[model samples]
Target: MNLFNANETKAQFILSLLPITLFFPIGIGYTGIVLFFVALLAGGQYRDKWQAIKDSPMFFPVMGLLTVTCCAGLLLERPDGFWKAFMHYQIYLVLLVFISVGAGYWQQRALRVFFAGAVLASTLLYLNAFQLLPDWSLFQNYRMYAGNKSILIGILLGIAGGWMLNQICANHGHKWLRISMWLYVAVALLFLAKTRTGSLIFVFGCALVLLRYLTFSWRSVLLVIGTVIILGVAWQTATGFRERLVGTVSDIKAFVDGGKVSADGIRLEMYRITTDIIKEHPVVGSGVGTWAIKYPERAQGLMSAEMATPHNDYLLYAAEIGAIGVCALLWIWLTQLFVAIKIGGENGMRLFTIGIAIMFGGLVNAILRDALFGIAFMILLAIPLAGISRHNYKSHFGDLDR
Candidate 1:
């Protein structure tokens, strides 16, 4: 029997628009989230929702992380900090809601919506990069109307690139088109956006896709070699790319030689301070939201600007919630990857690509700490996982209303 009534159906429809909204301004995405929650409450079916949440493999790990953060916050007498952390981590509840109510059809629809949004956003960015767009200040300098940072845009594009790569691998319709789209995404990330983390994500995602789909062969070897040659040529010729690469190396060398904190130097300093903090509170961490409190105190006159996180997700978690929180974080990522692999379809490939992006991207940025990346990560993860779960359910029990 259909569990959804008219109100519930409307709620689902609103939920389906989330991916597209994410490509808009952040406030619009937040508004959409708020509206969806309100609609969900108006169409409540508590019993079924609870069952769905309980059945999700992600439930325990997510809850565990939440519990740890909450406890750390409360016990450490940092209610304000706890509240702040909760604000960031509350995106997980969105994922839970997705598993509870999102149907396979809606999930697929959402993925398609996301892909379309990505394409449109990419096209605009490309136009803006080339100064082809009307000289609106808002659209200038590769700035996205979505108001996301270039790095975040690159990561999102990397996710889209991964999806296209999967489609090409599966021999889906319009093979050349998919290949062209994939290349387009690569160019956007590596050239136009010029985000190092994004470029790394694209490269890493390509490796993962090829590893998953291709058997070891001479053709694969040649393909890899050719890719390397292209990258080498780009490195030599692309001014922005070469400068960023050279700048990163220079930043590290400057930091090591004279402790001069530059672009990457700030990250190194934060990592250094965070590691000390972790050593002191290795077990339970300094507690939720302690990084903002602790890092400045430790760095003192060393860092020029205030930083909330260490800019590295693993280190941030380890410093805030300790090793246990780190474990929970890893569990969340690994479990999601496992599910994506088990599903092993186009949707699975999409999820897998996102997983790679967040996991690798986390090394350079505190991915979950950022509003855009965090929200995108959870929603994208939930959509694909929900679809996979629905498929598994139908396989075992036959199709229901969903």
Candidate 2:
């Protein structure tokens, strides 16, 4: 019995409760995305339907890479265990993408306000993470928020940055709003810098995008962003940033050369093993779930840790399904970036999406830590996407925007 189509008024009533942002049904964000897409499809919407999803100019080519990669993985690796895990991966990532495209239907005004709320939500959580505020004991125990500081900060700043830029674009008739956005940037930087080691640098990346919108003169904006980057790089180097990045590896020369590092080490040893395995089975992989197996010893000796999968998400993809699998993963990323960059007229929603892609897309490295972060960044970023026109809803049968 499909609750969406069910004749029972009670079932429809329950369905209505699903979209409320107030009731963030934890552990079920994926379900929300899926239902939203189903609602769009079943409602019989049609205004530039295909254009909305996979929006980038080069989206089709990226999708081609994605399809080819997944095909190779499935054909080369016949492991049932890998299949089972991959099925789950597909379900969530697919829905996450759906949310991205579907967000365009949400409307320009609501997108900005909704994303502002999202930024507030992220800021509060981050403050908690720093213990400047209350820590979410639940998140600590659940460990689902993707233990990745860089990605989190990036998403927070990116969304906030986008919404702020959208305000500048919307030309809210107040010069103060633009100044307020710059202030928002400062607050965003405080949180981002404190958390991620590389994030301080990423701020320049954010500045570049902000520059584009800061002045109508694209060239001037570029110059401002470029100057900031040059200064940042010089200062970072003068202060021995390269050394600071060494982190746990700094004290341990052996690990740097041929000894051992750790998760703080980014568990590079696991990556070495995964890469080696790929060499032996380049055409396919050891199997999806099989990465959990013990890695063969390197020249030094037996591997130290018994990590099931490579810590790096992309490497995990390549290892599980080989080159083809990695292609699929990259394809999804490329497609997302393209769509986020596409302009949807003079509205806050387009600006917000572009900003998010910048902040989140720039740190593809975080995917190495948690696939969930990647998904969450893409998924939650949708709140700011412009809504479909009422015309499209009529095409979708009876789809209601509310």
Candidate 3:
């Protein structure tokens, strides 16, 4: 037999529980270290995936340099403070880069596994709301949880929703099953207003994708209207669950103290502070870890301290480094995604479709919060980016199966 199997069993195994474990999820620390070694054994005994990682055109050395520059500057300004922020979180970022390189070897399957892990994590977390699972912390000490159970559920559903939608069109016989599952997911999602932005964005994106498949003849339009009316009528008559729905709305009202414009409606303030800070530290940046202390003026606008991260990733990069840094990071992320989309467009790889849908939510979520800075996102997202390089290296050898 040849060395590696047709399936990258080792890598798949590594990633299988990764979604739940990659972050500071409870039980992921030493356990991850053990699993990581197991991944090496599973990934094949001898080879390093380094060369494959270096080939990604979008892997921006400049952005890394920029981050280091900012971090270094922070150290120079105040070593005590800088060490706290950068010292703890940066390791996950580095680990992701390494794992993604391996992903390059077999890009599509690798992605499926990663997405599967993410979905599983979301599912288990949602179950916690119903007491089906325990609320053990992800990143035990590092609880940078972004969305609530319902919101996270919706986003994961959005992810699976796209896959299900693709299967509906691409496959036969399993159509009803996928549709039924999505219907349940949608109903569950409707109750998740705690994460209004995440839930709504996901639902909207899925709806847009599904709209493409609709048979929009007059009959179809009438059918759609009738369906909506029936759901509404049924919803009203079904008073059994009305209190639960009302409780959800009431909780949402309490959350939106400032008119529920989303994220406490301080994104504009974040934008203002980011712009002012950039103006002050134009060239090399105020450096990492310094923003929270140095920019208190910006954060504590009309109310108390606004937030730590600027929320928007583009802005956060700017805050960390400079315009050049932000641009470099965006360049790396977008260029790779664009190339991947093109390749998918030409070859009919469904991964391209799924990635874009997830990325849209990621992009929007990034606009509202700092998931990228979080431990789980760094490890999970970085590896995929690095994997693109392996893909490039494979391209040069005229090999299609990799």
Q: Which structure among the candidates has the greatest lDDT?
A: 1
Number of the candidate with higher lDDT, 1 or 3:
1
Better of 1 and 2 by TM-score: 1
List, residue by residue over 214-237, the lDDT tens digit for candidate 1: 758775666567557756766776
Q: Could you tell which candidate, 1 or 3, scores higher by TM-score?
A: 1
lDDT of 3: 0.47
* Candidate 2 lDDT, 161-208, residue by residue in tens: 444544554445654765465445544444323334323434544454
Per the 3 Å backbone cut-off, how many clashing residue pairs does candidate 2 have? 18
How many residue pairs collide in each prediction? Answer: 0, 18, 8
What is the lDDT ranking, best to worst? Answer: 1, 3, 2
Q: For residues 1-402, write the lDDT of model 3, one tens digit per residue.
A: 123445555554454345444423334534764666667565663435544434554445434744665555645454346656554324334444445435433434434444454445445445654656544454222122344333443454555444444445434365566556545544444442234444444445455444544585774465346436634653565353354446546545654553432434455545666778878777556666666776677565543265666546565556656676565555544554565554442122233443454445444345323333243433334333444442442231112221
lDDT of 3 at 72: 52
| TM-score, per-candidate, Cα-based | 0.86, 0.61, 0.64
Alpha carbon lDDT of each predicted model: 0.70, 0.46, 0.47
User: Model 3: how large is the Cα RMSD against the reference?
Assistant: 7.3
Residue 85 C-alpha lDDT in model 2: 53
